[model samples]
Target: MSAAQIATGEIAVGQLDLEYVVAARLTLVAHAHARGARLTVNGHVAVNDAAIRVGRVHGITRDRRGFHVHAVAMINVIEMAPERAVLDAGNTILGNTIQSNGQSGVAVCCAGVTNNLVRQNSISGNGAAGIDLVGSNGVYGVTANDPCDTDTGGNDLQNFPVLNYAFDVGGGVIVNGSLNSHANTSYRLEFFASDVCSGSGYGQGKTFLGSANVTTDGSCNANFQTLLNSPVASGQFVTATATDPNNNTSEFSACAPVIAFRLLSIKRQENDVHLMWTTLAGKTNIVQRAFSPGGSFADIGPMIILGGTGQITATYIDIGGATATNYYYRMRLGP
Candidate 1:
């Protein structure tokens, strides 16, 4: 059945004993289903592009295998018991846009619901989480329900974390991005740096800079800040990935080029001047000096290589400069 806007008090689309069915592009508003009357099925079934709102009970529930919900919009619902989008394990919920629901946007509320892949969907503005794995005494715990759980070897989730560097006082690199998944859950963010940018081989020799755990805000947004050990040069590539608490990690985001440094400090020493900086690994820095501040600076030393799996602090020393003449120094990354 397809392409119908259902406005009745209750409508049953599929039977419990039916097999091989498809329901698509149906819109239901402020509706309900009779008790025990749901879109039940036994074999393969698909529900796509359906808009369901203000559902008094379960909306498009399933109890059997081969059920899939894609591109469906479910909003302002009270509950998604037995699973809002799927019940049986291995079912798929892909590209469905859900928001502002009274309960969870996607849920696994019953036993035997495992290995469901919930991917690439916009879920937010809900009363509860964008996704939920509710466990009860009637069933086993909600383990391995989210396909993004790496411990169970589920499907890989994909996320991109944005990085911003601040060079001012008390500054650090700020990483911020949004992931489309269950809200209020902690995910690990792994940062990597590469010497090259924009190629399949670019990140091949990438170095792991650091990692931090961040819990998604109510809106599924993640933000973190950390000081780097070395100075990241401009044009170097950087990328990040998200790993759920279960240790399942999403694919790395598209590599972005490093544009600036988080911190650079210059200090005058008794005989030699000291230059210190902090940045990610895998970046190369060139230090230069001039007789006067803002004058033409020439390369004074060899390129400094930052090597490690985390933030790095690098220092350079300039010796035998006329203390009374006032020498100037600056650092820049190699191309």
Candidate 2:
């Protein structure tokens, strides 16, 4: 637990004890680091109300008590009673999901990250906005992007919306947005839900630049259902949902099969990494590029349509360019 100089690092709960869970109660943090530092919270930690605060430079340059100058919210949270998981920001973050932390899921009071990607995370049920993204005069602004919705989670009787920020650009990638904010730059949201009223299902939504899009690829009647149906004075909200054609049915076959991923095999082959997996179904299956070694979850190059579903395989070439650090990558499955 020391802060010297972070080049490339990995911190996981699976590697550490449950001490962070206890530290979360006091004013102390579970863990925090900076300077090109890389962190991974792989579905293992149980640190509720875990606040992650990065150093900021406000006051100087009108950064507001040095709180503005710069702040990154790759998956940082703010706006909770005890400020559970209060975070500053990371240089380039990937593979992070924030859920029901204190009040605001991922409270981003005033933050943003350039050249970074946020994927498959839930920013839900805080007192305010699920994933708060805003910047003041002295604070840096957040330029967002949407990966586009791949799943319309309502077709199956088992799928329903849980924590979402999906918007009108595609279908359920961005959710619960503000009209009077952030120069109208579209943000992408990858959301999921536990199960439908009957079975278990999870769906994702997306929103890009100007337009909003939502899709419910699951079978839950009320899953992926927008609490605030309309955008908050934003230009327009476009939604596409798939439900049972009849009043009561469990035919997910007719239902749009959503793009869901389960890590199967991750291997390093020569200079490149070979990523293989299977999908329930996909409409637009794309491969994204990101930084780090054999590691990219962010969208870099133009998306490549890999075509249809079920046990698909794709390879990303490093071409020896990715040497010094870790590169990450993930498949973008949608319908």
Candidate 3:
């Protein structure tokens, strides 16, 4: 097409699917300048163009709640300016492989760009973050997570999920993390895996694993654990994002590497305790003990085991293990 296909004015477009749309300027522009103007673009491949643009433009009324861009691929650079593959959302950007763009893969720009759900997408190889939420300070990239997520800008400056650990079991991956956000709110958490973290140090969703829904407590805290059936091997990295009840999505969390170690079993025989764990080859394991769940854990001495080349089960025995009133044991991959 000589000019970009434009969707404007007050109308409801059901589905706009573009295959091989190429242009020097914008390929598809969905501007919600008129009230009740709704659009959904899906199964598209836009290269050598500004690709797909969405939001309120032209100093007019905003669009309604039906704008969505999903299941598309927007790679290749046209470098007109620092333009994102998709921008300025009060909508959803879901299940899109947006990579190597001139700017961010997807960005929610400026104030009042709320309820933009960015989920289930492999967003990487961009110049900026995979999902960039403009901070209240008018800066780009990941805004530091504030207490209770009170700060506001793009997507209300939504706080991303901080992962405690990601472990690759034999069958699947177990991911554990927590989200601190608006009180008594339900949020959607999406997990992704990457071979390496993005340059920005926040992260990029290289491979979408799975998603879970969590509701925060009165203290604005939600602890979640999910088992992802996707094929994520040990040594790969995992990341996650949080989308609030308003569909406002946050940036990718800092990458957490998938660990190959797991504390399998613990048994007590009289005053002795036996511990068994799955360990990676040529890796060192450390055992720690604590009295309470929230208490400090100290390393148990003279019990470290060095693993072999194959995945093997290692065992350690603690003499006089019943000396303490209560005991908790944990193992970690050591040096």
Q: How close is candidate 3 to the true structure, as a TM-score?
A: 0.62
| Clash totals for all candidate models | 9, 76, 0
Worst 10 residues of 1 by lDDT: 147-156
Q: Given candidate 2, what's the lDDT at residue 258?
A: 26
lDDT of 1 by residue, 71-157 (tens): 223322222232234333444443455544443445544444455544434444444334444343322212322322322212232
Best by lDDT: 3
Give per-residue CA lDDT, model 2, range 78-169, as digits (tens): 22222323224332222234443343333223323222223333333333233333334322221122122221111111111122233222
Models, CA RMSD each: 14.4, 20.9, 10.7
- Taken over the whole model, the C-alpha lDDT of each candidate is 0.46, 0.30, 0.68
TM-scores for all candidates: the values are 0.34, 0.25, 0.62
Worst 10 residues of 2 by lDDT: 247-256
Error of 2 at 306 (Å): 36
